[model samples]
Target: MTLKDFLKPDKQANLEVFSVSPRLIPVNKSINFNLYINSSAREGVDRFVCIWKAGKAIQENDVSEIAKKFGHIYIAENQRNHFFKDLGDNKNLATKEKVEILKNAALDHLDQLFHNTDDMIQSESIKKCLVECEAAAIGLMESIRNYDLFGLHDLIAELDFHDHYTLDHSINTGLYNMMLFREINPNATNEQLKIAGLSGMFHDIGKIKLPNSIINATQDLEPEEYIKIKQHPIWGRDLLQQEGIKFQRNHLNIIKNVVYEHHENYDGSGYPNGLKAEEINIFARMTSISDFFDAITTKRSYHTPLEPLDALGVIENTCGIKVDPYLFERFKRKILKDEKLDSALYLPKDFDPCCPHTALDLMYEDEIQKSELNENDQEDVIHYHWAKKTQLPKIS
Candidate 1:
């Protein structure tokens, strides 16, 4: 490997490396693991340069000085286990640091389990990963209860994502699920948050049964193909049940429920069950919100990503129809408060991407949205235009 590969963090390779929140470090404490500061080389590659050696007593002034320059600190892969133990043992690790640790570790586990492995992940491997993820989820919940999760994304490290759509999207959905629940119900129990994270991560596991031709298809699918695609939820629910029995994990039931019902709409328009509002599971409702948000915002060979505000407008249009209205309102508040957006964003008056559920019309609209004709837009017309919908192939 090149020296740059060793120093610089790449989403594909350096997922082994985890980040530290500088703000979470207790001033004047002697940390067991070494800490590195982020540095950009002349060639524009990021380098993690070790600024503090292991077992050194960090001075308050020095800690503050480091925090001024870098919001994140780096821990090499070798120190990952030690760093996690430190976090578990220490009482001072707050919401921000726990988030950093949780995301970093999640990428590692998911990459190992689901990265190109179609021959069914082994049960032992699955258990080990779940046990680890469960621990991190509990710690994150404790921190959430203690310090609160406001201004969270800013304090956490820059996340490194997988190139594969499911891998990267799963991470975003999982995080969004946790954040949405916290915003909607700040009194969530530890078990509830743990379920939230795992359920979101594995929500689309049903799609693994589908062929790659369907998943990566740039053009529209045939009628038969679309019918086959819609059965992933059923397949996923069955798989989750089998694993739950074989592995004896009682909590997998909730995850299975979400897996089966994530696509069900609030207005009873979705498939598998067509269950309406209040009839759907709460976590599944939350998953739909995250699924809609992340699906529209991710760029693919077939679709371009949407801006945050524009995407928010699209979601607003579907608040009661496609998603739970109450949860959507809370999610909107959470996003606005977290992003600190003061000004309104422009959107198309007639644009709604979710209807007809056909690929050509939706894809055409995606291109149109990017065209010059739509100069300034303010979509979802609360009073302006009657913005209705858009729903792309929900990537597995």
Candidate 2:
């Protein structure tokens, strides 16, 4: 079934009167139900005093005092040990294990949020997701510092084949952007890296506002439908602006720019104002390349997935036209040199290596040859040429 089929209509049902428990007796007394008696009452003003009173009461209670009032006993007192002994054991976990734990937690939280998007408050959900993204970014930076690229790639690729396109694409884009940003500026601060990571993760938040019909379409879009699709960037930017008030000014700006300009091409051929070259925000420019790479490599309703090498070639070929040429070249070199992805070209276990040639294979024939040549050339032709021309720091 299509995604549209999964979304039930927004139904507003009245709260049914169920049997009330003794525990709810006091709680009901504390709340002023009279405030909600009027059906036309706006929650903001009508419930303000009631909510404030409840919040004030909560703030006045000390944790230990509340526990005592609730007749709870501390096991530590009877056992002659600390109450939270198990919590400290995590400190002994290896750094790699810690990073993996953090990465998995982040992805799980994101998956939950995406699945419950219709039921949760959007602003609150986005805020929590950003916090998780920042934590994951910090862990990722630590992993990169230790040169644990293989483990990192495996963790990311584990989520690569999931059926949820938007969630998987957001996560992979964030990861690819983080890696590329670190390579481009190895000396960048953790805060800067986190911003890049967060930008990539939320760049497509606007798509959440699009009709599922367009988003999940298996066929090509009509001209009007494509126009609606193009408006996603604008919607994303506005949504972030409205909900990101708590973010630091600079971080929020980075997010807004990335969402707004991620689709704009380097050659002024893109939509929502055809920003060209440096006119596009730098974070947006970086995210654009990563976004394109993830989009083409991931399977979607409209197209078959392309192999990593072939995907890179498509990005390389579109350099200066769709993406920043300089950035694309750097990103390409990094992927080709990454030892972690050495087996990236190998077909998955279910695939037949000798299967009939597909359209992608034919289109990427020349690019595939270049990759093979780079692999087999004793002189290291690609590296030699890159070193001779580019001003990049030497790849270790």
Candidate 3:
């Protein structure tokens, strides 16, 4: 059964509910459970929480308290620790074990990405974080591409914008890297795909040097503020050189170009260095297309995210001027050729579905309703008339 089926409410429910274990059941169907905790003062709950314990029943409220204290809240039936342990330790089940490791790793990485904040970094710390993030992104890509790993869709669905621009950009870039990688070579080796994925994750690592105010700006800034933003590419190149990533000049050039030239224009009107057309690195050119696509499609602090088709239209409008003509053509062809890939570009209603996006959807719906109401108001006014001879009823 699917995850949606698993979350279905149980019938024959009891008010005096106790925890049930699904491991005891045979492999007949997928098991699902949801935790409910009472936090009302009259109900006398010190804390509202629930959790799963392997091979044991929750006897005391203290157990619940312990779970809550340790932050053991939601537990998935299929995500039991034993599953990971069994998958990790078994040699005969190498492929299955690898898939499990990769999936869990991806989920764990994403969890850190979504939940963690206030740990922003710039120099050495930023370097470490980028390395780990790249490792995870590349590893996940190789796992999914090679083994067709399970649980990826669910994991990807859980991605949200809680970790700020760095986190969101990392995940988005990694995802897009996988997309482009698959488009170019679905059967690529693990190493081949891994490097490409790493490139995606670290594409913007250089932007760490930018002033926080500019990076997190909510509205359009003055001309001077905009000029400072353009200096980020030079800052990025210097950062990479200091980090000693050790690659061919071409690869470094491409990556740095992406960092530097992502905002560059096709008609020779970008920033930092505005080398036109053939002068732009191919990787950066590819990134320019993907980065803008995600930027426009992703919900930002100041702008509503566009739908995929609308986003595509934006890309089309900028073609030959703002974006690489050849890359745009390639992107369009890929979208047209693959329905699934095209769908991936569009945000799914149930996926992520973060607070910001949920709020946007609600606001959009309300606006539509108000517009309809206004139209109806006009109709009512047009259809109504007051007669001077009308008589009023008297009440005694």
Candidate 4:
């Protein structure tokens, strides 16, 4: 189903909002709602609880004990003293406070992860990072509902993965994917936005399992190595299941489809599952286009990335074979308007091509000569330059 269809509020849908504590429940039973200690204001509902296929309310015997476990009322103002500045007048109190609280919580969580040891991945930090990411995903959707596209875009810049470019790439893709969603449907509700954001952020998390050498490799991968690389989606899917994050069919399906088919081709030439055309999950199709576009446009080891417009050309050339034609058409005209596309293609005047960190590590004469050619004497900068057609190397 399209995003709009998925988010249509079911007033008739019987979802119970318990006035008591929500605790761990088996996945086979009632859906456990994990209340955010901070920021929960939807129609004055501070706690979000969802279970697949709503069932009867809990018995009175369980209510009193649940209430005892979650004693005392939690207020947003109380949560803010530890996080932000003044409340700034009380207008739109619920929505505004929710934004502040969730954003701060997300930031705080990310900060803890960032400061953790290099072995942070092995610790609970990665899972906490994912939790924070989930919260930010929800908060971001609410932000989109109440703000402009540009304001939402700025919030994305704040969610930077400065520690690892790969992590940054995942979050940015999720953010951009949500941005595109907003652009397509200005009236998109919070839940749909949340799912899209979460799916986007965790799309390539399987790469965490691959060897750092393969992930950080600057050269072309060998055939066997490439095969090993392709196994990440399954690895990631299994890893996520092992973590015991209760995900419904829709959420799990979207996540799995994105992880597995984001590399698939519309012309039936893609990997893992070679289903083509309308057979591809709509969400996966959308993400695949975004993933490929961003991968080619963003800087990577094997190649100096193309500008966005050049990337657009590549998309145009590959559509029907590499991308869904209809989706590409909308993406080009609706999302990347001609003027904005031109602006996106513009490189900063002082942009550098060579990564000094990588260049400085070179030990060979040829490597030093190559680095010297890329270096700017006046600015001491190593700028990336476009190579001529004859200089292009073929992938083996």
Which candidate wins on TM-score?
Answer: 1
- Please write out the lDDT profile of model 3 over residues 202-312, one tens digit for every residue: 565555555566666655555687666666667666666655455555544555566666556665666667777767765666666666666656766666766656666
Question: How would the candidate models be sorted by lDDT, starting from the highest?
Answer: 1, 2, 4, 3
TM-score of candidate 3 against the unseen true structure: 0.52
Local accuracy of candidate 2 as per-residue lDDT tens digits, 346-372: 221112111111322323334444655
lDDT of predicted model 2: 0.54
Native-vs-model 3 lDDT?
0.47
Q: Please report the candidate that would top lDDT against the real structure.
A: 1
Per-model TM-score, in order, reads 0.60, 0.58, 0.52, 0.53
Regions of candidate 4 where Cα sits further than 4 Å from its true position: 1-130, 142-161, 300-303, 336-396
Cand. 2 TM to true fold:
0.58
Task: Evaluate residue 156 in candidate 3 and report its C-alpha lDDT on the 0 to 100 scale.
Answer: 42
Off by over 4 Å in 1: 1-104, 115-121, 136-158, 243-250, 334-396
Local error of candidate 1 at residue 383 (angstroms):
17
Q: Which ten contiguous residues of candidate 4 have the minimum total lDDT?
A: 384-393
Ranked by TM-score, the better of candidates 2 and 3 is 2
Model 3 stretches astray by more than 4 angstroms: 1-127, 143-158, 185-192, 243-254, 338-396
lDDT at 35 for candidate 4?
Answer: 21
Error of 1 at 85 (Å): 8.3
